[model samples]
Target: MEQVVNMGFISIIPSLLAIALAFATRNTVVSLGFACILGTFLAGQGIMGFPTLIKTSLGTTSFAWVMLLNTFIAILVAFFQKTGAIQGFSQYIQNKNLSRRAVQLLAWLLGMFVYFSDSFSPLFVGTTMRSISDKARVSREKLSYIADSGAAPVSVLVPITGWAAYLSGLAVGIGAIVTQEDAMKLFIKAVPFNFYALITVIFVGLISGGIIKDFGPMKKAEDRAIKEGKVLRDGADPLIGKELTEMEAYPGIQQRVFLNFILPVIMIMTIAIGTYIKLKSAKTMEAFLFVMIFMGISMFIQGIPFKEIMHTMTDGVKGAVPAIMILALAYSINSLSKQMGTANYIISISEGFLSPQLLPAIIFLIASVMAFATGTSWGTFAICMPIALPLAFSFTGGEATTLVVACFAAVAGGGVFGDHCSPLSDTTILASTGSAADHIDHVKTQLPYALICGGMALAAYLIIGFTSI
Candidate 1:
């Protein structure tokens, strides 16, 4: 059994500090790092706790895998940009002569299609559509919001994606789910109750279709783009960086944008789904690896020198260093949360207050706060599922399966809600980077919509909780 720290209310300090600092500073890495250091110190390891923190963080296999996956994604995006594939894709979209609303809808549709991995979906869709959206007078902020809305939300809704695989494993590990097959069934049943994700996706479609008018900062961004003919606000610093912004396609090759762009994307989708079916698990990293290899080979065949390809790859990795640092710190804080017994403390305190009619709504709210602070939906799942599943089992007397499913949905939906709104989230960062929007701008413009969906989800959970009871 895992040891629980007896720090009482102090256990929540790290997460609270992290969230407060992130909002105040708009620097996720610094905020998470400081919180991690403070948490380590409070764990009674003294000043030397910093070294132990780094070692523990680096020692985690998931951290390394996430690092590699993010780096590979950056490299693939760089390759696409360098080889003119992304430009070609943009040109193809431009040739369609679609109106602004149609163009935004197209980007939304593209995001939906790339649902196998949340990380890949935003990067692929945002990069491919950024120029097109700009041409159609769509704000970079709106583009980013569209990209992000389709990412984690879509992945969690789909059962074949990496999110589902990880979530199913967590369910099984908690012992509430008896088998992988049963876990998947439970996940599928809960999908309809994932109100935040469902509503977010639908809301994106409504916004793109002009049915839902923009409000808050998003409205200002859209007005700036359309009225002033500026895709970005004046003085906005886009997250694409100078290096990637200035990268040019290789010389002396006819840019067959359609063939170059579509082929690799198709291959990625095929490998992701094919491998999942064959292996009974999603091979997200392996899919990305193979896609990178295929992209390199294709570039080489197109007369781009191997050295140039390698340079682009290196540049891509370098560009992703900032995001990687943030992710590393986020992971470190999650580890600290585990050691500090943050989730346990929260659960223990809430146990006395939980009732069947309020359990789902309460769980959703707590999971949302935890994920928002940590900037990791998976980490929230890891923390919440163990407590939630067993409590759900007890609350329902192991007979109210639908109520249990509703609670599961609340947790999953809440995680996505928090992740969608957090500037510290990896997918949120990728959406901004891929769309060439300012990171804070992305966070600011997207938050209102996320909050709206989150509120609706919370209310839905309450209704479901009451109905089930």
Candidate 2:
């Protein structure tokens, strides 16, 4: 194990291998599986480490929480389809005859409004806006980009979200942020300097508003949709299977169709927001569970039989299989990354690059690369904050300078760049499933836009660093 730790370049092989295979083959499961196996072997474990690693990775309470949440959201999507609620809502929006720009704008707004949870925001907005966007001739790639732009980027912008809480908790005892309140204040102070999140969000809005035109792979998808009227590309494999995407409305389900959709959403926002305000930690899963319970009872009372309800739930679970399989492999590889001390190796190699005038930009670049390779923004935040904050303090002689705040925001925003674009990011996967877009296509189309924003953010961080001196 020590030998593995000392093997600096070896730590990154698995993640890099995953990235290369994913792009070359366009198969997430195969890419992730091979990376997991290679990573396990590299960590000094034999072939038997594969199963053991899977058990340890997926056995965590965190993985269970994500698994159930993904399943529940899928089930809710199934129920929405089965009851014709989603259709009714889409028809209602389409009946207004909103233009494509307006429809995209609406989706962007929906994503921003669901600012409480990164996990919830993209999926909810994607599911809630997919049909309407399709009817407006918007490509699924565009929809995924909008959904993703508003996810981790938006979550980190707001103060009450789980992202904020986790970040603030990490910041505690660092520099001037000794208390939770102090950490929160520091987070807020860093918000405006969080250049990537700000730019990414604004870019989405501008694109949606028709102030900016589509470019890169996204433009190709949009062109295919506009000229051919194909919302998804021909032969694209969507993460959400036809089981839920094509699920028919249950027989004898007729009345209050729109209400069926609205009530549960209301319940989720109410409970999740309410708990976060009162309890600091957001009970996001509980909110989804309550919505499910309400939907089950409400649908039953709406004259759908109990057997049909159970059957719809079953179909929902089945539809979750494709996404879950990919996610399981993703988790396994991420676990291997942790065991190999991949992020630590990154930090170690980055040590020589830190200086006051260049620190902010360098930190942002390092965080971005680490998050991209590992596919987890929060993991980057967790590892980077402890090091970045202490470095910022030492560089500033413990005075709260512009450099310190800029560094803080650099890590926050840079990590989100990975979440927005990386194939292995959960938010990216959720965006695909929610929009029923091909996962690889989503990654491909969104990558250019994310990189543009990342480039702008990097420039801004550089300015902040030089000017702060």
Q: Which candidate leads in TM-score? A: 2
Say what the RMSD of model 2 is: 1.6
For every model in order, what is the number of clashing pairs? 0, 0
Per-model lDDT: 0.84, 0.88
Top lDDT hit = 2
Local accuracy of candidate 1 as per-residue lDDT tens digits, 346-421: 6677767788889899999888887776678888898887778888888767753878898888889988998888
lDDT for model 2? 0.88
Candidate 2 runs further than 4 Å off? 1-6, 255-258
C-alpha RMSD values across all candidates: 2.2, 1.6
lDDT of 1 at 425: 82
